[model samples]
Target: MARPVWSGALTFGLVTLPVQMFTATESHTVHFHQLQRGTSDRVRNKRVNERTGDEVPLDEIVKGFDAGDEYVVVEPGELEDIAPGRSKALEITGFVDLEQVEPIFFDKTYYLGPKGKEYAKVYALMEKAMAHTGKAGIATFVMRNHQYLVAVKAEAGLLTLHTLHWADEIRDPRKEIGDLPAEAAVTDRELKMAEQLVETLSIDWKPEEFHDTFQEQVAKLIEAKRTGETVEKAEPPAASTNVVDLMEALRASVDRAKSPKDRRGQKAGGAAKTAARSTARSKRPSKASSFDSLTKAELYERATEAGIPGRSSMSREDLIEALRGARGRRRADAS
Candidate 1:
């Protein structure tokens, strides 16, 4: 089991439950080391005194506040002395309906687990109560020397903590973004078509359906470089032109979304299958775009649906080829 990132007691009024927090999500972004171009030498960063041009040791570093024509140097120890006490507890200040909280206020999320078997009953009670009432416990706590505002809600029989930005942290969009259109009237026909287009494309939320295509491409590029293979560049997608007619765009979108897939037969002749494939690509009816435009996960799903053998071990290119082959077979059989 993974170790908990934070362990603290959660308290509200007279009730207290010892719990541990674990990060609920993780990023899969590819990281690259800084290096000189065309060379293997790594570039390193150092903290140096601007005036003296000398490297500074970690122990010698001190934060300073800029005052008028001077500075107020402060030591790490001084900051620690005045820092918010780490009480090792998430003290709930209030309980409010979850709907009252805006999504923009939420930041990171953590899974809350009972610290021990003895605490499970109390934890379950709190979780059930919150879930039943559709309320979240708003709390403030200090962790890693930083104070955070968080909302605790029950989900899937477990407590989930969502850290939120303080009220002052959110910027007013009107102040930051200038000259926003106040209103643009839409014709009833256009509105109806747009709503229909939305309805046609909407699907139940399935996070597994999405994948980070850019990261997969980066991994593929790295693998190609390691194997001394030539990397092929994909053509950029055509830039979208401004929509002259809202109704026309909405109608086209709805049509594309509703288009049925072409059925070629598994036993069809090679020439017939090739023509079918060409026709399919030409239509590009919302789903027949090239492999480059799709995520690795999307390609994997296609491979799975096609019943491609050994797809689990295949690379992106291999998956694409396997899917194409499967489509050809299906087309031939249908014919």
Candidate 2:
């Protein structure tokens, strides 16, 4: 079981529900320690007194603010003592429609659960009420001596607390971005073509189907280096669309998006297989013909049927090669 990061009382109106907050997400990115070049020695950081040229113990450290001529030091305990509600209370000021909160303001998320089994009913009631009304409770609480503006939202039968950035923290993009296009005129034909392209490429949001390919490549690079093997370089980014041929590019994009292969890639379950099969049937010259004519989706279905290993991660060319190898081995066994 995961440990809760915080234990507090949630307050709204006359009700008080004891809850525990657990971190909702964690990073899986590969991390590396700093090392000196041409040596295996790890480069570590240490806190040292500048004037004395000696290491300083953590206990001796204090938060300091420079006030032009001098430094104002503050103790850790002093901040905790001054924290709102002594950092134990999460009080909801009001509830608002979830859509009213801009996505830009949201930050980290924490799963909020009933602290004790006895408080389950109260927790469920609050979650269900908020979920039914599509509302989020706007709250303020102090945690780890820092006050946070948060939204308590109901998600999948549980409450989730999202920390938010204060209004002053958000930068004005209009002031920051100098090259933003100012009301550029878009031709009606180009707009229609672009809309058509979007419609053809639109897909239902299935987060599971997407992944961090760059991270995967990074892992592959590490493994390849360890094993003295070569890793394939990733494809270069696409060239910027030519302004002179905007309509032509849009039309071509729409055509490509409408292709059965691209359409099948977006679909899932039986629909994907059906589309792949249909494409194969329409494109395949003969049963004995080469797999070059088949799309990656069709090759993947064939690979799945054959139980070829690593088919999920393989490219279209890789799939075709694997399928051919599988067929050759099957023929050899039969003979």
The window of 10 residues in a row where model 1 has the poorest summed lDDT is 259-268
Instruction: Quantify all predictions' global Cα lDDT against the true fold.
Output: 0.79, 0.84
Return the top candidate by TM-score.
2
lDDT of 2 by residue, 1-335 (tens): 89999999998999999999999999889898899999999999999999998999999999998999999999999999999999999999999998999999999999999999999999999999999999999999998878999999999989999999999999999899999888999989989988987786566665665555567777888999999999867446468987997876785556444555555565453775566557746764565878988766667666655666565567666778888899899899999
Error of 1 at 56 (Å): 2.3
Off by over 4 Å in 2: 260-335
Error of 2 at 262 (Å): 12
**Winner by lDDT:** 2
Candidate 1 lDDT over residue span 1-335, tens digit each: 87898888899999999999999999999999999999999999999999999999999998889998999998867765665545387999899998899999999999999999999899999999999999999998877667899999999999999999999999999888898767877788888888887886566665664566567778889999999987666436545756575555665455445433323323444785457546745654355567767656557656654555565556667678877888788889999
- What total of clashing residue pairs does each candidate reach? 12, 0
What TM-score does each of the candidates earn?
0.78, 0.80
Candidate 1 global TM-score: 0.78
